[model samples]
Target: MKTLMYVFIVALGTLACQQEKKIGYVDNGTVINQYQEKRDVEDKFQAREEAFTKRADSISKAFQLEVQQTQIDARKASQKKAQELMQGLQQKQQMLQQQMQFEQQQLSQAFQTEIDSLIIKVKTFVRNYGKDNGYTYILGTSDAAASVLYGTDENNLTQIILDALNAAYQKQ
Candidate 1:
């Protein structure tokens, strides 16, 4: 029984010393940059931003013209009526300005949320890819040159990860 116990302990020790060899690494920056979905989202956001800017500019010009017209009418009225009209116009301008500011804030929040969500999606894809491929460990490298020094191109796996991520995104 003692001899059997010694054999079992030796076997265990041997197994422990043998590490899993199927480790892979990927450049996350390269994957994200090359991902078509990420590029599409960025382009869409840029277009939306440009549209918002144009709308804001158009509204500002229209509001300025209206305010100028109101001022002219206020100058022509009786003194007391002129003062009241000017005050009312000022209040309306303040309200419109406040509304515009609120809309801009909402837009900013929405854009930030969208970007955060996309990053989460990319992270999820990386996690799932690692799990599905039976990798013992997957390291993320931001520097391609450094990665090449440590990992072979066969183990880079960025293209595979990007492809899997896009496929998963499309399915979603």
Candidate 2:
């Protein structure tokens, strides 16, 4: 009976010596939105989009002028010449439309690729942060769905992690 009592005490002591797990959560939307690197990328993409819009507008205006001139010239042109001009204009319009579509797709693809890569970078940063800070688990919560529905304010690490991430990005 004494040996069993000793064993129980030993077990209790061992359990007491083990540290409790440290856990925290971050707000996913807040982190992504507030992250400086993401903002920078978005700003750069916006500028590119603006530039593309300007060029598209220029192309459209030029095409409109060409159509107006062709219409005026068609009245004085021989029937065959008028037909050729109309066909040429149609072909040019189709080619311009195709080019614009291709450019838009390319821009969209590039933006998606960059955004995907940034998300991966954020995930990696969070993982490394957990490992470095001795976190047993780090949960993510977002407006769409909460991975952590109930955590104390003290356990919310979104701002801390965001600040750290921004600082690291600035150093890069």
Note each model's CA RMSD in angstroms.
3.7, 2.3
- Badly placed stretches (over 4 Å) of model 1 are 1-8, 141-154, 167-172
lDDT per residue (tens digit) for residues 11-129 in model 1: 99999989676788888788888777788877887888889889989988998898788789888889999888888878987897898789888878887887778778887777777
TM-score of 2: 0.90
- As a whole number from 0 to 100, the lDDT of residue 148 in candidate 1 is 42
- Per-prediction TM-score, please? 0.75, 0.90
How many Å off is the CA of 96 in candidate 2?
Answer: 0.6
Q: Find the 10 residues in a row with the least total lDDT in model 2.
A: 13-22
